[model samples]
Target: MSARAALATALDRIERYDEDIGALLEVDAAGAAARAAELDRSESHGALHGMPFVVKANMCIEGRIASCGSRMLEGYRAPYTASAVQRLIDEGAVPIGIANMDEFAFGSSGENSSFGSTRNPWDLSRAPGGSSSGSAAAVAARMVPFALGSDTGGSVRQPAALCGVTGYKPTYGVVSRHGLIAFGSSLDAVGVLATSAADVERVLAVISGADERDATSALRAPFEPAPARTDLRGLRVGLPREYFPADLDGRVRQPLEQALDDLRRLGAELVELDLPTTRHAIAAYYVVATAEASSNLARYDGVRYGARIAGDGSLQGMFAATRGAAFGAEALRRILLGTYVLSSGYYDAWYLRALKVRRAILRDFQAAFERVDVLAAPTSPTPAFRLGEKLSDPLAMYLCDVLTVPTSLAGLPAISVPCGCAAEDGVELPVGLQLIGPAFEDARVLSVARCYQAATEHHRRLPPLVAGGVA
Candidate 1:
């Protein structure tokens, strides 16, 4: 099929099925079709020519409303395109719409999105691990072939794992963050979600280099094709003891063990590695993420870009009313927590101490990388949970990042590829095998994921919902 045809089909799927899945907050059919027509007429198209994709609402996409899943910016529109989105468009990709996410990318269950929760296509009632919830769900549902997401603390990888798709968070600075609405500025990185590793690579290649607009972007390096090695003969794979918690679900554990056996058979050398600070990753991640968020979000004071509430007479009234009316309960909670932690007399006690712990975690990962080429673990301790599962308890929601947050905090590359399905209540739930690599080693990490993917058909399976069948 031509790129236009494929996009048309995807659009049809979105219109027909997204109401039930709640994966997309917006769908720009006319915009996508216009781009598709342009691509069809252009003779000189690049790698992503005519490809259909989605951007998380947090990323600016020109005319699209970059709400970031918060009511605060419910009717807001971007004045300019996100650099990453623009780069993809230049390469011939058509952005179909903006995917749903947790409000300001705060929660893990994806239940916190102000728009509504994006269901795991594998199990409609189950939560799609978030805050990249809709990015993963849309790709899994084939509403779009690939999508863009932002990860601060396991957002991309966790959701991808839950949805049974490939999601990769590149090393910090490898991809430009110019258009991405900041959550945890230093920790947030734009990432890709797709059905296969090859698709992820295709999108990454087009947007990986540095941009003058984003000082943190990595400088362009000479093109080097990833080594094609299916065999993991000399590759050192580490199994971090801290990742396997005592309360891990037995159902998920079985498939994880089977994956280890499969990896061993593929010739990878299994090594027991100790990342002692892994236990502190979740705590450190929340502290650092919220602290940075508190600062970055100060810009949305209604005087600048987003929604504004009418005040009685004073400037103080305007600010208070705007924030009070614009933000959701969850968004307000994070902002308040973040502000308090960074306030005088509390900075050293909370934010500063969290930074110290974060440094120790990074050091631990660096020390482990000296011994192992990649770290392996189950992306989540369990598969998707029922909707409204952990929404009531903040700490419960935070714990969902246990297996995925450490790699994120250290600014390393990681990929989540479906390994197998665990049976729960007579329904099969997808299991994801996560691979962590040293910073700037995205190719190596993806290469390992591809090897695993080639040996297993887990990632190839799609949720039945795309065809309007029961999940």
Candidate 2:
């Protein structure tokens, strides 16, 4: 498709489905048309020519609102484009709009957005999984070929699992975080959501590289794509016993087992192993994530950019009033948790220990990679739960990410690919099979997902809404 044609199709999809899905917070139809026109007239093109995509709200796009899905930064325009995004633009991928996200990229359910929750396309009553909810839903609904999202913990992978699309979180330093608004500086990873693993690989090729603007960006040569895998022969796929406990939901386990069988049939050798630190991942993730969040979110105290309420004509009161008015309930909860962890006499007990646990998690992966090419597991413990199901229970909501957090904490490369569907009261929901690789094995992770998708039709299944079976 021509660039303009691609954007037209995306806009049409957004118009037909976004109102019901709540996937997009804003649509840049006119700007995208202009960029598409420029692409059509240009004689030269980059790898992603004619591609249409969206940026998660937390990522900057010059002149666009980088709201981070919170009222505090609502209407706050981005002054400069993010380094990763600019690279895509350079390669001719057009950005159609900003995708919705949890407030400050804080929540897993996407319900924390001040803008409103993004409904899952498969079932409007269900969450698409989040803070990257909109990105995953948009791709699932065919509104865009792919989109960007920031993954802290299981944000990107979890949503992609719930939404039935491919989501990839590259190694920590693979993508520059220069334009991404932070939740957890150490754990946050800019990721991608797409209709297929191959599409995701194409997008990542353009965005992954060294960036002088981001100190954390790895000083490395341009990304070299992994050779395509025709079969899984000689590939050892490790199954960590910790990832599959006796309590795993039957619906999730069934579909994942089918996928594992498919992998085995494709000639992959399944080896069982142990990652003893798996149970501590959630506790360590929250402590490390929230502590970093507290420090990163401190900039929005009504003194800097974002919402402000001048209260009682005093600076302290103004700070309190502004934060009180702008931050969402979940955002406030995390901030408090983060602050308490970083408080005097508590930092060593909480934050420091979490860091130590993070290293242990990394070591666990390193040891596993010594014996296997990749690790296979479920992305989320269950299929997409109904919206508001876990909202009232913070711990329950946090536990939903149990399976995916370990990879995030370890700063490894991982991808969630649609394995099959699980049924809930006769309604079908997508389940994801997560593939993880050691640090910097991003290409291998993507390659494995692509190979699996090549054999099975699971990733080909469409949501009811997208298939026109539902209103």
Residues 1-34 of candidate 1: C-alpha lDDT, one tens digit per residue: 5778979788877877788889899888888898
> Which candidate achieves the best lDDT against the true structure?
2
How far is 449's C-alpha from truth in model 2 (Å)?
Answer: 0.9
Candidate 1 local distance difference test against the native: 0.87
Whole-model lDDT values for every prediction: 0.87, 0.91
- Model 2 agreement with the true structure over 1-471: per-residue lDDT tens digits: 799989988898899899999989999899999999999999998899989999999999999989999999989999999999999999999999999988998778889899999999988999989999999999999899899998889899999999999999999989999999988888889999998899888988899999999999988866667888899999999999999899899999999999999999999999999999999999999999889998999899898688999988799999989988899888898899999999999999999999999999999999999999999999999888889999999999899889888998989999999999988887889999999998888888888899999999887788877787322
Clashes of 2: 0
Give the clash total for candidate 1.
Answer: 1
